[model samples]
Target: MSIGDGYRAVVDLLRHLRFFVAVAETRHFGRAATDLGITQPPLSQGVQKLEGHLGVRLFDRDARGVRLTVAGGRLLGPARALVDAAEDLLDQAGRLGGPVRARVGLCGDLGGWTPVACRALAGGSGPGLVVPRVAGSDRLLAELREGALDVAVVRHPGVVDGLVGGDVVGLPTRLLGADGPLDVPLAEVDRPLVVPPRRHQPPAHDQLVDTLRRAGHDGRVLEAADPTQRAALVAAGAGVALETSPGAQASGGLPPLRVRVVLPAARERRPEVDHAGLAAALEQALRR
Candidate 1:
């Protein structure tokens, strides 16, 4: 009456459970084999081996179709749950070897701040970005709330309800145009304004519009998605554009044009996420 003598069997536990589940679901060995993409003989042999290991018959054979025995009926639910948990564990294990991803959104990458923030987040080592999505400030904020983005670096005057953030830097802005001499007051310039889409950054849009109206312009503006396009329109004498200060453009190799500091710099910050560790990392990155 040795312990090993009573129960001696070798079986791949997970494989046996999977085979049992397939057979239990179909109730027909032939149908189960077809579903599992295997031959009926191996399926029958696996089920027999599983029953021998458990020391109980899991199914009843008849002329119509197979049916679950008392033991099989009791084990089906737990077996399915176990298989699901095992697959999920395997998936997480595969991700453990890869760098953790942080989805970041940007409001037009103005003044080249988006790249700077991304480098800071990477800390010079590990996976950097999951393809930064560019949208208006309003859309970016909305994405942050919807759990689509882990963080976002956006401009001021945009609504950020139910989110926490910290200002990382201030990007001083200037007016670009062909008609005005560089360094004049905003009121002295007289050119149709070329601005990014107002729907994306309404606060900034209204500020510029109101400021120009006081200067005697009719409050008319042309919309362009790309800063380069804005600069092109201004260069071609189509209109003036509010853009990053001249100092910020020095390294970007933008087309040369008359520039004057008008509106002050906009604040750049990151929206909060749920995880404390990740939020701390983002705060640290913005500080850099």
Candidate 2:
């Protein structure tokens, strides 16, 4: 093949490699397609094309789902690296034509920590602009996967597949009730547990519910969409809600909820941003 033909072949291979990586990580063509913003047929075809080019079976399809073959497992890391490199090249090229900005997502429950975290990120010498988007943990995760945000402060105990980061900080919480001892046992609260919708942060919601159950509270749960609503419900004698304490020492008796700093797994080591330093700063600021 001519040099031009060879270049086209590599480009074509990279396209297929993206498909391979997505499917490999998600372990399901349907979910991968949705994540990739494509239909299932094209995704399947792209993976098939990649397999044909590599001369190996990458995945075993079964009734349950897809599983990586031995060969696939071996090549997955390298394939991810190549795809990430290509994306980085494009990203850097785009940066050359414009001012650098980092889109950061913060969880809704950060409360007083929100302003501090924003200042920490914006004050950095890294990006020329720091845009902050606030939402629930699940929504933030989706935006990260879709490349809508560069980094996110997400709630712990939630799904973070295909991302890389560490726990940044934890905020202790206290039970807020209209009229009761602050140190009352959860089982003795008598009112329902007021919390946000489970769909917003499924794992954290389940963890909270399970902990309450274990603490002997098997009563009804009142769903509220935001902190204000939860607080209002608590004040109305509807239920007791967990609210972040002013300081670590203020925790009534519940476990602290944690926040983690996560970026796309592919961009974890990108030199454009100092994610670790930002996380450390957040930990310090939030702790105060």
Candidate 3:
């Protein structure tokens, strides 16, 4: 076989090349499996496939562990180099001509994350129009502080120093449960609440709490981070969870939740921006 063709044959091997290499570096099959978060049987099979492709043994096994054969030693650096080069290429693409990426928050409170930003996902990523997802919350406050996101939709019970809310709209706070729409006022139900923590509290939670008490029943907020978990808890007949305008119902055992504005007390909070210029550019692009 030609030398270039031989190299290509070795390089084209599937999964086990890395598995074999990891075992060689770690000097233990168990360690390699742990590193890859997989079981050792599959790791052994991968190594076997890789060795078969090369027509040479890749490692020397012993009572203690494994060590690389001469053939294995030769392949290690090149394999790692290939993986690193691919990662670098991807990172560069995300930063350059890929899309107009932004971190935006959308909650019952009509924050600065305009419909335009969320709508970008409907369109593919390109020069002026990539709505790559970061997260969905005023939690942009954290990302903005870390300088990771270009702009974010942030809301407050009060004002932020540098950020400003976009042409914001007010979302109605509603009582949501496992079935269709709920008609009872908050004072009537004596259920626990699934809610975002105060640090991550969306505007609807605050209104739900206040409206519940005013309507006559006391309100308490139970904290859960994942939406599906909250829905599951509700399905288990745990209690009533608050629903905001933008979030949709999750599928499976969870009943489609109900929503209606039982109170007029709550209002919309504004999302703040740091650089008006970036916000303006994104907003303009999103409008298209």
Candidate 4:
């Protein structure tokens, strides 16, 4: 094959690998497609192509769900590395041609503080564009480690292995019930606690549950995917939601949920972007 043909083949292989990794992570074709912003048929075909090229069945699909084969499990690490390396190379190329672009990820429950932080980052005297992605703490950390994100403001008590930073900001949370806001003890409320799924932020979820239990709330816990859903559940009298607010006073309430900025430990790879300076800017933004 000519060099051009080889380059195209490598690109196709990378696409298939990306599809495989997405399906493996989500364990569902439809969900993976949604995450990848593609249709299910194309995603399935890509994964199938990858399996065929590798001469192994990567995923076993049944009526219930998808499960990875042993070969797939073994190849997942290297596939992720390849995908990350490709992305890093593209990012570096972009930086070489233009101003540096910093990608920042923020936790979903930041409420009004999200916009404030975005404005601060965008308006900074920094040299390039500031792009913000919003997601759960777990997703942010994973992206940070994979080199997809330059920095992230994740919830405290997160799994920050291979990353660095510390608590920088705290936002007070209020318990919202069907009638309205409630300032009473959690135990006094005779309803379940509505929160995001534990998988999204394990440490924060476990800590919140433990704290609630100690406060005498031995009730059911409803897991919602986002804050809007949680608030809707509360409004429908399903449960009470702990809603964070930037305007909330911290004088006499439950301890505010803390946020911290973190960057990958391997800073030498992309010396063009000042990760520490960006982190400091984010910390100041969240504080304001």
The top-ranked prediction according to TM-score is: 4
Flag the better candidate by lDDT, 3 or 4: 4
Q: Per-residue alpha-carbon lDDT of model 4 for 34-65, expressed as tens digits?
A: 66645589788889877777889999999999
- RMSD (CA, Å), candidate 4 to true, equals 8.5
- In order, what is each prediction's RMSD in angstroms? 18.2, 8.8, 13.8, 8.5
Model 2 per-residue lDDT tens digits across residues 91-163: 8796796765677888887766787778766675433367789888888887777677778888877777777
TM-score of each: 0.50, 0.64, 0.45, 0.69
Q: Residue-wise lDDT of candidate 3 within 1-288, one digit each (tens)? A: 323666565444524556766787799998787655455897898788777766888888989668888877898888677656755776677578544444433332332234544554334542243333333344444344333454554333322323344653233345567784455766676887776554553553565567557667677767665666777776776777755434433222222222111111112111222244445544444333
Question: Where does candidate 2 have its weakest 10-residue lDDT segment?
Answer: 244-253
Give the Å shift of residue 211 in candidate 1.
2.6
- How far out, in Å, is residue 76 in model 1? 26
Task: Estimate the overall C-alpha local distance difference test score of candidate 4.
Answer: 0.79
- lDDT for 211 in candidate 4 is 82
Rank by TM-score (best first) = 4, 2, 1, 3
For lDDT, the strongest prediction is 4
